[model samples]
Target: MSTVQAAIGLGSNLGDPISQLQAALQRLQAHDAISLTATSSFYRSAPQGDAEQPDYVNACALIETTLAPHALLAALQAIERDLGKIKRGHWQAREIDLDLLLYGDAVIQSDDLTVPHPWLHKRDFVLVPLAEIAPDWMVPGKGSVSEMLAQLPDHFIQERL
Candidate 1:
């Protein structure tokens, strides 16, 4: 299998989020089909919705994988499940969250997923770490990750850990 570069955004707001994220990273690094190449420092940010919920620990990872986009997504979803993540509703608090921010330059639109995550540009939690490892990565319909970070609205507070 050939290697493909992919990016993933991770966040958690419930129950020892920092530990959860750290463990998730370890599991990611352990995967035989995936090589975690780079990672940004953890960022603390407020919940985008459910403002009363706990703040989240967020970060992004750059990975090299032999799996296809959907296959990679499946792998991520499985990891989340292992960490007790549930998709109860949009923006709900969870033990761990993993999103496929990008898959090479592949443009994919499917009922279950979207490459270059739909809201990545608007979320500082996503863009900040993304910029760390992939400042030059281009969002298919947008510009560079660094440029997008510069233009997003000032709503979220991202502090590096």
Candidate 2:
């Protein structure tokens, strides 16, 4: 199978988030279908919703994968589930969250997935770390990663780890 360069956003806010992300990275590196390329330093950020929740540990990863989009999403979901992620609701605190931020510049919309994640532009947690590793990556209808990072609102709370 041919490989396509892909990007992923990783975040966690519950149950030793830093370790969870580190373990996720290790699992991805061990996956036969995925090649770990670049990874950004972890960042601590305030939760976007439900201000009552603890801050999140966020980062982005660049990979080369042979898995089809849906298959890749399934792989990510599997990893999340293995790491004890519970789907309580959108933006809810979880042990781990893995998002397929971009998939070889493909724009896909379906009942199960969306590439170039719908809110990729609006979240600094993802963009800031993405810029560190893949600043030149072009978002399908949007600008380069760094350029998009420059355009986002400055209200988010982010601290590198």
All candidates' lDDT scores? 0.91, 0.93
| Local error of candidate 2 at residue 131 (angstroms) | 0.3
lDDT of 2: 0.93
Candidate 2 per-residue C-alpha lDDT over 14-33 given as tens digits, one digit per residue, 9 for 90 to 100? 98999999999999999999
Q: Which RMSD does model 1 reach against the true structure?
A: 1.0
The window of 10 residues in a row where model 2 has the poorest summed lDDT is 152-161
Candidate 1, residues 101-161, lDDT tens digits: the string is: 9999888999988987899889999999899899999888899999999999865755788
- Which residue pairs come into collision in candidate 1? none
What's the lDDT for residue 39 in model 1?
Answer: 91
Candidate 2 residues lying further than 4 Å off, grouped into runs, are none
User: Residue 99 of model 2: what lDDT?
Assistant: 97
Pick by lDDT: which candidate is best? 2
